[model samples]
Each structure stands twice: as structure tokens, then as C-alpha cells.
Target: MSNNSILLIDPNFDPANSANLSLLVKIGADTFSYVIIDQERKFVHAVYDEQECEDGYEKLKERLKNDTYLNLKYETVKIATHTQNVVYVPQELFNENEIALYTKFFADADSQNIYVQPSLQQNIYTVFSLPYSIEKIVNHNWQQSIKLEQNAGLLELAVQFDKETLIIDFTVGSFQFVYIKNNNIAFNQNYQFEDTEELTYFILLIVNQLNINMKQVAVNVCGIINDGDNKWSLLTQYFDKVEILTLVSDLDTTILDDMPAHYYTSLLALQTCG
Candidate 1:
């Protein structure tokens, strides 16, 4: 964790009771966030951290070794990671044997681990891949963890709520863009941006091609962008409906007091994965 990372927990939270809490984690090679929620869907503990991609794996190892809350036993564990190599197959058409054909999730087929992510609100199966090392670390740390791609959570929200026609999630060096039309994912991809110019090009290409109504688009921006940041300035200027995404309404978010609610909306939404 860095100086800017944030961790919060209810002072009265009982360590013995963690057996009933559900752990939801959103992770990437470089960034990680997780929440411990009770059966009532209340967030009791949360942590968000980021660093250079090279150090992410080390950070994960350190945190898991030293973080008491994370080491606690949980009734359920759900994890989500961002991957651009995704193939959406209908439930009926999904073939477990053929899933191995999805580009080895961008790795040598033998070195990659594939995951099939299912959604309650959508009929399609989100099949994606992650490095074998990443999956090994996660599964080794927490037994029986359900895995999902980040876009699965974003798409789930779009289908269930019929809102946020487009969502943009920012992280350390990249951002993911999801466009939902008619309650289905139209476009979802992650892009690396070295400067605002590169980001503007991608955003404009999508907006111009879709000819989206800036007024009614329901553009929600979440993750790392801050007020007046280059990404923030570009987005607020591009869409009239652009705004920081709010945390899900189903849980008590007062745990986030004095924190940026928008920064973790995507991580909190992984609750939908469970």
C-alpha cells in the first residue's frame, strides 16, 4: 500500500464473525480493492490500493500475509479482474471443451487460466482469461473463490438497472470503457493512454461513431479520475450527462465518509458478481 491508499473498517466489527461475511475483491496486476460485507449487505471493511504494475504481485503477497481481515475465513469469496480478451457465448452455445479456444486469454495456452463468468441478469457467459500466476495466487490465498472479469460487473449493472448507458473506469495506466445499448453490452474495452490526447481520441471515436446523445447518454465515470484531472476535464467536457458514479444504494456507504465515493463504485459493484 502507498501513502494514498485507504483502508476502513467498523470499529465494532468482530473478527470472530468474519465467517459470515462475503469477501468481494477487484484486482489487476497492479491495482486491487476489496470489501467485506455481511449478510445484510453492509460493508464492514474496505481497502483500495495501487502501484506500478511491476509491484502489484508483490503487494498482493505482502497484503495477504499481513492483513488480518483478508486472512479471516469467509463464507463466500468473489473476485473480478479486468481482461480485454473476452468472448461472450450464449449459455446454450457455451462449450467447456471449446472455451480453451479463447486465445489462451492472451497467453500461451498452457500458461493461461480461463474463467467462465455467469450473470443472473444476462443469458450470455463471459469467458475470459488471466495469467496462471494470478489465478494461482488468488485461489491459493482463498479457497473456492468465484472468478469474474471486470466487464461482467459493469454489464450486470447495465442490464439490471437499464442505466449508465456508458461507463468509464480508470486505473493506474489504463481505463475501461463499456457501452450498453438496449440493456446489452455494445462495447467494452481497455485502453492505455499516455496523455489526455490519446484518451480524447478514443473517447471521441466512440462518441462520434455512436452519435450518442450527450444529454441523455447517462455517462458515468468512476475509478481514479479526480476533479480537474485531465481525464476528468476531458470527460466532463465531452458529455453533458457525465458525472462521478455513486456507490450502489443497496448498502450502507457511510463507511466511505471522507473518502471519494466514485473511486470505488466499480469495486463495490463486484458485489453483483456474488
Candidate 2:
């Protein structure tokens, strides 16, 4: 495990007999994480999260080579590869034939492995790119074609709550703010922030531009930030219904009782339905 990694595996989990289990993997520029779930029982068997690797890409590939649990056979394998070069196109506007036209907007398009994830419910297609080397590594291990998503777990929040909601998923230096209106994505983008003031400004600007009433909208936050952290503090001051993210599932993940509620939002969102 990396220096600041989090690992939790149930005592009863047996890697040798994982035919009924499901594997969920999340890879990013600086992190690699995976979760094992007993699909039949709706039980969480294992959760391994390692972040902030100095050589994240290389380290994760090495882990994929040596990690015991990761190589096991499972009912299915789902991966979420995070990338900033992503564009959302409405169903009517999406052109599968002209994919290169979309890549023209990305500076590193030539070096990326691109894939599209569609949301039939929302009627939009999320087109994203993953670095060729990393995507190849993922393909080598999973032995299956992978569907990559960038901040798409956030849409699960919109599905969970049928209200005016603003969901912010935070990382070290950036946050992806997704606002849901009329039960679909109205505004979605990532903003770089150095401090609470910068985050506050971005939220205020987006809210005003979208005519979202902070008092009426629900603000659910997750990831690196905590309940009383600077960013969360600032949000509570400006918003009325501010809350940390909760698992949108009925499964009894008793192990999570000791951990912070915000720790696994996007990671677990990879599996759980609204």
C-alpha cells in the first residue's frame, strides 16, 4: 500500500473463490483504487484505496502486476479512469462518425486512448480520454475492454435526489461541480482552487449564472475534504442544506461505520445505483 492508502477487507472474503464477486477499479493521475463486492449478497468484501503516489501511473501498473486480489476472476470488472479532457454532448449532437473532431479540442488527444460512456437516462454521451500507457495497462490486467468515466459518478447523486442539487467532488487542487436541474445535468465543470476563497467564488459564480438559489438547492460534498475543513466550512456558511455524501445503497457495509462518510463517495458510486 502507498503511504496514505486505505485498505479494508472482510475476514470472510476468499480471493480464490471470487466467481460471484464484482470488481470495481478506479484509476487517476495520482491514485489507484479497487473494491470487491459479493454481488449475490450485496456485501462489501474488500476496499483498497491508494492515493498521492509520486509515480502514480508506474506504481499502479506495478501493483496491478503483483496485487493478489486484483488478478482474481470475478463476475464482472468495471473501471473508472479519471481524465480532465472530457466533453459531454447531447444525444442529438453526438457524432460517433466524427470522433476526431472532438479530439481536436484536447492538446494531448494524439497520445490518449479515448472511449465514450453514455447515459441513456440523461440522454447525453460522456466522451473522455485516458493516457495510452495506463489504458493499455488496465486492458492487460482486466482482460476485457474497459469503459472509462470522468466524474460521471456524480450523476448518481442527481438520480438519488430529485431536487435542485449541486454536487461537488473534490480532489487535492481541483473540484468537479455538477449541478442538477429538472433531474438532469444543467452545469458541469471542474474548477481549480487554491483556497476556500477560490472555491467560494466559483460556486457563487456558477450559482448566479445558472440562477440556482443556494437556499433551495442541496449541496452534497465528498472526497479529500472533511466535515469542518476550510472548504466544507465555507460551504456551510453560504448554503442552507449542506451535507457530506452518504452511500446510496441499502447494503450493510458495516466496515464503513468507523470511517468518515465522505471517504468513498465516488469510488463506491462506481457500483451502487441511486
Candidate 3:
């Protein structure tokens, strides 16, 4: 194993980390996950979360007392998501400074790689680039041959247009709208909800508030597909061109195991790029 690699630990046993890469080992009360991305190359070196521990920590310690398994050492711990369960590995593994240096290595729509650091946190008081208060939603013309950025295991839905594209973030119960026109952002909206009904209601409310007719819009239902239930069946009743996305043509079909409802949407985004 490379010294510059780290592991992620999960205590909640949430399936969300299943798609994430890096060294994911389920050791009793914790799970480990990690991913190495080449932002410059638009590629990722990821590890699957299928690693297992041969012996329990307590058992390992007891075995070590008897000089059984040897050479076990870990250092440099970090925590992600919930409260205070840390992931530990070698200290020299993954320099934070090196990660920061590659943070700016991103590509533009023209496929030109540029060094730009993403905002670690959004500014609350900053105004939108253009002064149009997006109090309502806007629907532009739709196209089938549109291309979009692939979600690195993130659930994403996008509606492409000639002038702009509307991308929806549906990874969680809440919703976030990001609009890009002429390769520039036009508007953003965020909404929180408790259930799918509220989520659908919020979508309709946004459309009505923005004076956008449902007939002219296309909705993609993603992320929670194979729960042995149909969550998007209701969407067809509201929109004329609703689509349920699946994997791209190039991906292996075996990836369909543990298919989340939004997996189809992720596949659609990948298809756009293809």
C-alpha cells in the first residue's frame, strides 16, 4: 500500500459510502472509505468498500500479546460527516498541502484544464453575479444531445438547453438548483423537505412561482430506483416528458447491484458525457 493513502471510517453503517472509494474496512463499530482523484486528468483512483478484518481489534490485541500477527501500525486520523469517530493511517499518507495544490485542477466546458480553487465555503452575503432575483423557476428549451459533468458517485440530475442548463442536486432529502447559461451561472435555489411528497410539491411550487409551464419541462427521476418500489411513478402524472435515467452504454451492467433510485440519474449524467 502507498504511504500517501488514507482511510475513511463510518460508524452509522450508512450505505451512502458504498460507492465512495479508498480503503473501506468494516471493523466492528466503524467503516473505512477513501478515494484518490486526479482532478487534472478528470479521473479517479478509488477503492471499493469490500475490505474485511480477519480478526477483531480485541482479538488482534490478544493475539499480539501471544506474538501472532506482526507489523500493525497506523497514524494521522481525521473525521468526516458525523460526530467524532476518526479514521487513522500513516502520517505521511496524503499531505493536506498536496491535496490543496490539486484542488484548483479542474476543467472548463471547453475542455481546458485550469488551476482554480473551489470555494471551501459559500459566502452568505455575496450577491448573484447578475442582479436578477430568481424568485421563480425558469424553463428553457430541451435537447437530447446535451453533455454534462459526471457525478463522482454523487446523485445528480440535469436538464440541458441550448442557452443554459438546470442541474438539480437530489442526493439528500432537500433539493438544490444550479442554473448555467452560456456556461455561466444564472441562478440557484435551495429547498428542504421531509418526504418525497414534499419534494414533488416543492418542485411544482417552484414551477408555478416561476411561471414555467410543466408541459415545456423535462424531469429526471434519479437515485432511489431499485428499492423494489417505484418512487417516480407519480412524476409521470405531473410532467409530460419525465425520464428515469439508467447507466450509460459504456458501463458494465453488473453495476446494477444495490441500485439506488438515483443511480439511474447518475447514469444519465454519464451518458451525456458519452
Candidate 4:
């Protein structure tokens, strides 16, 4: 176990059945977390980095190397991240020649580093990027890599709710807001804030801009938030129905008894995507 990382392993994890394992990794600017599960959707092992590392990818790779269980081949691997260079493209307007369209919305698009994920809606797709070196590390370690998703928080939120709803996912120093209306995505964005007030202001701005009825739309929150936290209290004041997001019902939760299920909502949702 790494000094700065926390590991939780299910008592019944079977090393002999490594072939049934699937790994889900969530990499962020300063930290990373991963969960390993068996084919039955039962958690095998999980780890979270408590302190932010300047070289998070390197540190994570080192930890993975040292952990004997993690070295085994898994049935599938999925990686998700939050990157600024992401753009949503409608299938009708997207073409090879228009790859540069991402730059129109996000100024930092590197032509050589782009990746795309087709959405459940045939007409929509998402374009994003992962650092070349990090992508290489993931590829080298897990040859069965399934898909890499950018702004995965929003993607997870989009599929969880089908009606008019507001979803918020919180991380270390930032949070993501996703609004879904009429079984379609209305607005999706990420924001950084230093305190509860800044977060509140941003939410208000989005509500006004989208003309959302705060009273009518339900707000679902997940990630690093707790009921007693200031952000939770503040959100309750503006929205009549604010609730913490819940994990998919089919997943086994015996090993996660000590932690809030909402914290792993995004990782669980990744299993549903490509």
C-alpha cells in the first residue's frame, strides 16, 4: 500500500478468477482513483489517492506496478478524465475536414491528440483528448482498453436522468454541471470554485441562462459532497428537490459499506458506456 493512497479489498476477492476482472480508472489533474470489479459487478479492489501529487500519472503507475493483484490481466479496462479540450459535435456537421472544429470552442486543441466518442444519440458525438504519455501508459498496461471518455462526469449524468434534471458532480477543486431536458442533453459544463458562494453563483448563472425552473427541476448531486457540507445546504435553498446521486441498483455494495455510494457513481456509470 502506498503511503498516500487508501486501498480497500473485498474479503472474498478471488485471485484465481482474475479473468473475470474489469478495471475502471479515473484520472484527474492532481489525483487519481481506480476500482476493480468482477464480471458479477462485485468490487474486487479499490484505491483512492488522498493527497494530490504533482506527478499523479507517474505515481499511479508506480503504485500499480507495486500492487501484485493489479499486475494481472483484466477482462476490460476503461479510463475517464476531465479535460478542457472537449467539444460536442452533431453527427450531421461532423466530418474529417472539420476535426479542427474543436479549436473553435476550445483554443488548445492539438490536431494530433484528438479522440472521439460516439453517443447513444446517433446524431451526437464528443471529442476529447488525453496526454499522449498517459494514454501510452494505459495502453501498455492494459491491452484490452475499451474506451477513453473525457468529461465522463457529464456523460454519466446524461444517461442517469431522462427528464428535466440538473446533475452536479464535485471533485477536488472544481465541479461539473449537466442539465438534461426532454430525454436530451440541454447544457453541460465544468466550473472551478474556491468556496460555496462561488459554486452557488455559478449554479444561479446556469439556471438563469437556461431558463430552468429551479422549483420544478430536480437536482442530483454526486462526487465529493456530503449532506452537512456548506455546498449541500446552499444548494437546498435554491432547489426544492436536491438529492445525492445513487449508484446503479444492480451493483454489489457490501464492500462499500463505509463510504457513501454517490462517491462512486461516475465509476459505476462508466460500465454502461463503451
lDDT (tens digit, per residue) of candidate 2 on 1-274: 6577878888877888787888888765566678888877888888887766554577667777778898888878888766656787777788999877777776465454667777635556787776777777777777663565756676655677668888887776567788877767777777666677788888889888999887889898887788788887888898999988866676668777788767778878777421
Q: Which stretch of 10 consecutive residues in model 4 shows the poorest summed lDDT?
A: 47-56
Q: Which regions of candidate 3 are displaced past 4 Å?
A: 1-167, 178-186, 225-231, 246-274
Worst 10 residues of 3 by lDDT: 130-139
- How does candidate 3 score on lDDT? 0.32
TM-scores for all candidates? 0.85, 0.87, 0.37, 0.85
lDDT of 4: 0.72
**How well is each residue in 121-179 modelled by candidate 3, as lDDT tens digits?**
21111111100111010001111112111221122222233334444534334444444
Residue 121's lDDT within candidate 3 is 22
lDDT of 1 by residue, 1-274 (tens): 4664668878767889888888887766557677888857565565555544554456667778878887889998987875555677666677778876655555344445666777775556788776577778888878698888866566666664475478888875678788877766667677776778888898899888988777788887788888898888888787787777766656876677777888777777777775
Best by TM-score: 2
Report clash pairs, candidate 2: none
lDDT of 2 at 74: 84
Give me the overall lDDT of model 1.
0.73
